[model samples]
Target chain A: MSETPGIPAPPEEPSEEQASRIGVDSWVAETERHGRGRGPLWQLARLWEYSPDPVKLLAFVALASTVPFWTNEGDLFVFGLFTLLYAALGLGLNVVVGFAGLLDLGYVAFFGIGAYTYAELSSSQYGIHWPAEATIPIAMAAAALVGVVLGFSARRLLGDYLAIVTLFLGQAFVFFTGVANPTVAGKGLTGGANGIPQLDPLTFFGYQLTSTKQLYFFLLIVVTLLATALYFANQSRTGRAWRALREDPLAAEVMSIPVNRLKILAFVFGAAVAGLCGTIYAAIETAAVSTNFSVSVLIIIYAVVILGGFGSIAGVFVGAIVINCTLEFLEPQNDHPEVKRWLFYGTIVLLIALLKPWFRPVLVLAGTIAFGFVVHAIVAATTAASWTSGVPVSGASWLARWAVIPTGSHGNFNNYLYIGLVVAVVCTASLKGWWRMIALVPTLYLTALVWENMLTQNGGITAFILFGAMLIGLMTVRPQGLLGTARVEIV
Target chain B: MTEAEITATEKAAPPAHPLLKLDSVDTYYGQIHILQGLNLEVQSGELVCLLGGNASGKSTTLKTILGIVQPRNGTVQFEGEDVTSRSTSYRIGKGIAIVPENRRLFGPMTVLENLEMGAYLHAGGAKEDFDRVYTLFPLLHERRRQLAGTLSGGEQQMVAMGRALMAKPRLLLMDEPSMGLAPILVERSFEIIKQVHESGVAMLIVEQNANVSLSIADRGYVLSTGRLVLEGPAAELREHEDLRKAYLGR
Candidate 1:
């Protein structure tokens, strides 16, 4: 009579019913004696749990907080600035989706609102100049107010309907900012496509945060303070209530947790955090562009939050660091293609090394190598040397003879190879053990061929490809992320 | 009283001025009607059982009374006050507690935390309630720090009962407490339920095993296909010919 579908009914299985027939207390005793999640990954999870939190936090802070000093401004901006920015953004999102169990697709709208409000107050576009202290608070308050209003209006809607409403609201925010920027005093208020620029730099107590290093330190400080505050808050009653609401809203409401009020409070907190990040973002870039807060960026933040482990404060940092660094690495390096090329080969090697059953990886590697050379030799012998003359990417010249990269008109000829490669990869996922291994041999070869031909030509497109691959890989491997505990849900 | 003694009673009417009442309740899940014109009542300090086969709207009645599901056209009253439109929490605050089906323990939380959650409205932190629960189910105290998910089915059931008791409710609602338990455990659990019932709280228990529930229940109601078909003292209902054919597997 229990509504939970996945719970095993006593009489459904003979063994269980027989166990129950023996005695009730013994069954419970037997269950306690048995192990849960008996696997290598679960063992690793145990080990992770045994490690102390402060020790891990200190190590992470040491690695992250010093990034601006060692790297160039470009690297610092790419790796340091954006990474921390996204971490803050991701943590904000974790509160709503992970803690409060609310599907707020309109989260980015608050972030956008924070940026626009700050820009309007501090930038030349509006001819207003509020100090950083005043502007940031006002922006955050405005965003929180918006979040409360949205939460109050949508109180009756739950789950999927809530998601749809927030999703539409997000789209409306984009349209209003990008195309529907109403004209005030004979000028477009939001600057339309160009966006509002010439924003004031972050100034504190008669000193200006002019350099990337200063901004990085400021951000590092803010992130640490916020993370600490969130940690304390999570230890309080509010966090427990939020988690209870997330687990089962109906149950929580009945248990006297005040579900609706808690949901709205979650939104307010999430919006405030997002608002802070948005103002800082505008300050860092000296601009607030509508294009900056597009749906893609929203997805990126969601991916980061999910990857780091929902509801985990530390996980968001880890997610942000991994994602932002990878995205930065894939940025167009016209003068230096070695980074992308090395990254591609390194990934393949890593996958091969991690392949299960030890010998299967060796076999797959040997097969891919043999398959490449045999085809290359046959192509060269049958046709011209120029037909198989193209080289491997970067300085890996020894690979040139075996890897068949067509010279001149390196065109849609490889398009078929790439398409086949996609199909082969997808097939490998769906195939069983032996068939998957068999498919992998061709899939590996095709991947190399595709990369050498099409993927290497444009870092822009490959960035997305790499992101998609990483997200899929993370979900399949560890949905809990770096520091999150695995949860069991009723089906 | 022994089974032999129970059969001696043929006429037992419910006490006047029942503590809770559902009048002509009609519930629907989108299109299909569930609890069709269902009327039921539980007297103050009485242990009542609602029995039915699957999809007979047994669980639906509990949900309706708890406000988890709203009846289309009916009134549910608690102590003479209409509670049909009240929120589930509001009803709970008014001395109603439910042991939701399958225990529904917050799996990640420790047994202690789960009990604490049951007393969420208790600002004084329910130390006395916790002690009372521990006294009733000492195994819960032994496994107070253990995660509810790791516990066996029977132990999880105990935790659920202990959790509901922590609310210190005047009325308790349990859905299939005997489910997934061995026969011996069911008897032991029923003993505990009898103790709780004797301690002056009214109870409304929903079950598929009519015989087991009716053994301890003061009175019984049989619901089939969203309607009550029989009602009487537990001793009389247990011997009812129609109930034996459909439920007792005789």
Candidate 2:
């Protein structure tokens, strides 16, 4: 065969004619004559041509706007502030479960480490309080080191084995925090189970982030930054290598991808994000408790990742927002508060066993919309009626009614309306054409505004109830997630 | 003359250093010795096919060359360099690519992705390589975005071949490329083998289909129980009546 100057021969020509085209005399002149590379725009255009979907630029803008008002509200701002932080943590776990296919059972330990790091360095634990700004970097660095240790263990172990080790790591952190009494060294260094109290909020460029609304905006910015960074990381060569490793480790190794290094990077990345969340949590909550970083938290975060979809960044965000909002808004009817806990966890396990095996997409979407509306209505009705009645809220009866089964309060009707709109928006998005996705903006805005209202309220039955409903919706309609699509690869 | 020039002149360029040279390479699967002291070589641009019985270790010979199986003793050399201790990935990194039997395409990935994965090691030059692959197999180009698993057996084979080409290997190793295909596909596959050899890459192929293997092979080796029983030019191997009677269908 006559060899081409620039083009080599095809490995599977299967014919003489095919071989001749590839085996040309010279391709340099031919390639040069084509004259490509106009500018960055041209490069972007070329990429757009190859990619599956056009980028959603509007979503980025809306999410960006939320950061400004995150920490400004009073007590109501606390939930938004924490939600932002927790969502950031979820993104970190996304790298482990989504990108790397590593199941971490002790993710909270990293979060705990961040809290402890912040607590010890700041006024909460130690008398020698460092500036709040300094704690962020310090906490992140410490968490990264712990992540590396976890990564080393992950390289040598796999599947359930890694999960078992991470579970122990979580337990170890809890045990250390619970038992270690370092009063001899300093006044508030360990803080015991009471954790750190009166930890200071972050101050940026002379701007104070003390209120819940202001903190919410701050956290929103932080989570957005983390999510964007993770998105790019997933798109890069390193991220591709991680995805390949997840799909098939042996084959990935054979391709010279350095499977071990990629796994560790994922571990450290996830830990760093978790640590960032902890730093924010300490600032927002004004106190930290061991139970806040308990095993249940791990289960909930894992549920978010799994229910959303593995290897999807968008899915993680959607999962976090849906799960957090529902948990915030819905509570059980007040009469039987005890029943709510069983229902909350039971739904998760049942969905995993039964619904997840089949019809997962349908179930998850339906449940998300349902939960969103239910929480919206309940919270709205509760707030509007309580305000109009000028009723001084009685504590125990309200709790009982919220728990056993919500009796009709003015808030309950609002909850129903909220749930209805949520279902309608989800329906429109799922079934409509391109125009509908564009049109979903107003609906999402309304939903978010209502969502923020319910979340800002102190822990309520409507929030828990909505969360259960959303869980059911997520399990049924879109097991991949509320806003996520299933990814199918051809062999 | 200097020693270097003297040696170069005396050996007729030393036959291009046998793009692949396997010397007494032994391989085993746990207790079973699959390949016992296998020796083989293929010069640059030469098309050599190893012919063997069902359990004669032909497949294992190719696997050993690819470093999928570690050789217990002796050396496996590529381009005059010993690669016995190298990992499979290192072998691939050194521009060695393979089309394993049954076409182990990543079932979930598209044909294009599979081909792209072949050039996974290339990093920057994938688009050029992709265009080159598509030019050779227009059918593959048409179905480039189609899942490799969903394609017919023939299309899947094209993906396997395109993926190997993506690596731009100097030596291509193929194991049973014509394995369960229809007779027509088998003929088509042989043509591909010949074209690939003509593209400046040396080839070492193992096959039970001796007639087709011998047709494209410049030189051929016949293996029986991990030992070389026959070696000759392709024409001579095709005419070997005793070998034909026993192994190839008469």
Candidate 3:
């Protein structure tokens, strides 16, 4: 099959040397860009990356600053104080992971250190009483000093090893406060698992912040100032050095950036910020419990940072707000089971609207309703009418008519229904075209049934479930977070 | 290194010391001995090429010199000063520069930024160093704003060399400069190396391309299985029939 005169003579090859360079360079570039994200989310993130800092900061501040004025104090505390605490924590983590590229899984320990330090000084547990002014600064300094020690110890450890060390440190912190509080003057210094109670509220001069509203605004000011300061710091020389080291530590070291020292600096900064957040939170709650600084809290903070985007301050702020608000909605104390039900169904409709084309959405909607009723009828007619006894949440009589409501006691049957519903949802997701539509019908009916009988009673777990799902969804769809720039990293 | 090597190096060291020397260096990657009793030298302001075939410990020598890998025995001396115990960054601080294999430029950084990293030791004269790099590789100056990852092979090679030059190094260590280039580009690269040497930068280059490397090298050493098999003036080494037959496979 020798080529004819014009048949491209086997594509004249570059010298082995030249071709090798080309192959390596192109392959490296292509591979580095392999898992790089794109589409509307990525594009939107890219646009956000180019936004003016002041405008972005001001916009976020304006939206957040209005929350207290328009919402109930409970809503304000939920959306404002906790969100700000998480945002600060997320920003601190961003410095370590996003800027310095260090995976510090024990960041929550620093938060705990701050909280406990504040508790120790201000709480009546050991009859040690101090003003917020002295206690908070001491807590933060103590936390930062601890961070420096950890950083120095872990300076030689790279990446995953560092992560392991930090994670264990976090566990150690929990153990210290939860199980190892030393006996001091006939009372436990840390109060063991019960934690120190009757803590002083944040007080300035003679005036004391007793209300959650005042605490919310106090945290608002702190978060805003911290965000602005962090933004400036990220733009400074140290920031550039941190980013360089993040890209390649060896190169940075070879380039005279003092890689080890910089790593320690990043750790110190992150710890100090976390400590400050913890003090404020402990003061507001008037208690400092070991549970407040567990791995679950770590995951939430990580989710906030990752969800917002790694390097962007704005991203972490937005991430904290969204995650905290969603979590609050799931809390049983919110007294609105209706909100959760509506959110569940609304999410289903949203998914359909997103997944299907115009006419198909209507078709899926109608199909899902009709299918639910048919299944309900089959279960009701064959079994007893009393069998469909598990009541529907809110006043959705139609939903009750459509879904199979078990008549039995609050029993293992609901657990089976929940498991079956999960399996159906998974199957529906895997199926394609008409098969998906067919699967969706039964999945929808099972979902309603489970919500009515199972998830309703188990509202206790709803917060964690929602947060877990949000994390997984975020990692899959847009790992860069809404405000972070999509970075192309070398393997 | 044995006592013989210690005494021999001590006696043979020239009054104007070699810019870089690896005397009876023994290096190992875990249990695998890579460089055994390997002695190599690059005299001040001269170009030296360490020629070897695959797995002949060529890259290991460069890494050892840069302190990325430590030799289990023997000493790495620069300007008659022992630097075997120095860290990689410490060596760089002492005016040693490296253009690693595959041109490991910070892929995401701009060309200018990569050069800036090269001049990290001397932040006071970065502008002057940038000008020098630009003078040597004008193409780099033209595309200084472009991310290094996006550059072509020839351009990246230029960037790598320019980055090394930016450090104002006393001894520049280049690993596999002609490794993956067209014959013409290889020649162009050699011309640049010759120019850098002409400007009084002592360089020790590691390469598999014996012919191209020896053509421009002032002196050459042929290494096989991490031990020196041949050493002479570049011209004599080029014509060494035994080396050509046994190692060069000419």
Q: What are the clashing pairs of model 1?
A: none
Give the 10-residue window scoring lowest on summed lDDT in candidate 2 chain A.
A1-10
TM-score of each: 0.85, 0.69, 0.83
**Candidate 1 DockQ, CA atoms:** 0.25
| Ordered list by TM-score, greatest first | 1, 3, 2
The fraction of correct interface contacts reproduced by each prediction comes to 0.32, 0.22, 0.29
Q: What lDDT tens digits, residue by residue, belong to model 2 across residues A1-491?
A: 12212222223323432322221212422553344444444354344333332133235436445444443343244345445665787889989888888878888989988887887776635465676688888898899899998889668688899999999999988877776745656464557777778876666655667866667667767776777787788767777667667766765655556678888888898898888788778777766667788897887787677665777665666566656645643432222223333443344445333422244434454454555456545665775444332211223333222221222354564566467656755554455444443434344434443343343333465454445445654555566664343444333
DockQ of each: 0.25, 0.15, 0.25
Per-residue accuracy of model 3 over B200-248 as CA lDDT, tens digit each:
8988899988888888988888888999988877888888898788656
Instruction: List the global CA lDDT of all models.
Output: 0.81, 0.68, 0.80
Can you tell me which runs of candidate 2 are displaced by over 4 Å? A1-57, A60-79, A180-192, A205-207, A332-491, B1-16, B51-63, B106-113, B140-151, B179-183, B221-247
Tens digits of lDDT, candidate 1, A420-442: 76666666766777787888888
Expressed as tens digits, the lDDT of each residue in B1-39 for candidate 1 is 544454554335444556899999999999999989999
Residue B12, candidate 2: alpha-carbon lDDT: 72
* lDDT at position B39, candidate 3: 91
